[model samples]
Target: MKISRIVLASVLMVPGVVLAGENARDHFRDEARAATGELASELMQALQAAMQEGGPPEAIAVCRDRAPAIKTRLSLERGWRVSRVGTRVRNPLLGMPDAWERRGLAEFQARHADGEAYADMEKVEQVVEDGQRFNRYLRPIPLQGQCLACHGDRDQMSADIRGILDDRYPHDQAHGYQAGELRGAFTIKAPVD
Candidate 1:
């Protein structure tokens, strides 16, 4: 009788365990999305202000300096690793994507190619590295009209802006992007508790 009772309880708990896991994933997804949105909004607003105050060339300093500082602050505050990465990166400091991020970027590109709206594109997963569990999330960063001032076709860039980019990032590969194209992604990873 006791054995049968134990078996019944185990069976009953199975569904609960599965549901809990799903709930946890959902919670992490929500947290990641909120954090990503906040960071992106902050960065975009700063960049826009810089462009208005100065111009596209001056905005390059924001990307080169301010963006990383924001990432660092957010990572420290939220206890998550946060960053922006691109397929073709301008800054060598933030260019290389890790294995997981590489996979996420490829998936984003594939989904975009399949006609998925960039704004609606996101990737979330549970990743285990060295026996540690992490919730990884990435959202596409679509190019906007303002971004074109700097990231547009070479011919479209003024010589001054082009020279600034060339001098700052001689090996830059982030160019020739059009509005509505996938510029890159904002990636975040939080440890699973």
Candidate 2:
């Protein structure tokens, strides 16, 4: 009877453990995402203003100049990334996608679907390659519309966009994307001091 009672208790607690873990992950992800959204909004506005100028040349200059400032404003000043997606280049991060996941992502985009945030519940569990613990959160960036052109389809890309991408991100692998697709995760890692 005791053995059965203990077993039942463990079984009952299993769901609670899973639920708690999910809640913790959600809390952490939400905090990081909320912070990132504020910064992204500012960057978007800046990029829009720059795009208003004469041509791509003018816009590039504006974005380039402001890039450093934005970085400074947010302490992601040192470690952060901005990318676009559909060119022929392949992304290094995409390298980690499981075969089935890669196919699922592709299908999701082809259908113009953007999974709900946490649909996949991605998180930075650890940085085994290097060294990290309890000190970081990984946040994924969803591809927004502005990110579609070069990141969506090479053949479908406009000459101007391709030109801009070529000129700016020559080795870019941020292409072949659709709105709301998972672009990459912000690997937030720090020393476990």
Candidate 3:
């Protein structure tokens, strides 16, 4: 009778534990979405302004310079590691994914191929690495019409834009993207209490 009672008590507590876990997951997911949205909004506005000021070539500076600064500011402000990583990188140093991130990107591609809409796609997990717990999040970034100016087919790109890209990103492999294709992801890592 004692054994049965103990077992029943344990079973009853399971839902509470599970509910707590689910709540934590939901909180982390909400935080990740808000942070990612903020970064996207700021970057898009800057890019639009840059494009208006001097076309795609001048807009390159927004990505090359301003984006990193904004990301750094966000990271510092939010106490999280937030950044973007590309599936095909122009600057490998800045855009290469770690092992876990590579798996996430592959999963994203598989989901996309299976007809999942990019706008609705995201991955979130509680991961433990090197004894530290983190809430990791990834959201797909689809190439838009404006993105085609810089990331579309090299052959279709203007000579001036190509010249600037060649000069700036000599090892570029981030081109050839069509509108609505997955360009990369916004990734976040936040500590979990």
lDDT scores of the candidates, listed in order: 0.88, 0.54, 0.92
Clashes in model 3: which pairs?
none
Model 3 steric clash total: 0
lDDT for position 143 in model 3:
92
How far off is residue 142 in model 3, in Å? Answer: 0.8
Please, what are the lDDT tens digits per residue for candidate 2 over residues 27-93?
6566556555655677678767766655445555544566446544555543433222221334333
lDDT winner between 1 and 2, please give it: 1
Tens-digit lDDT track of model 3 for 1-193: 9999999999999999999999989988998899999999999999999999998878999999998998899899999999999989999988988888889889888999999989988999889999999999999999999999889999999999999999989999999999988899999999876
* TM-score of predicted structure 1: 0.92
Ranking by TM-score: 1, 3, 2
Candidate 2 regions exceeding 4 Å error are 1-31, 54-69, 76-115, 118-134
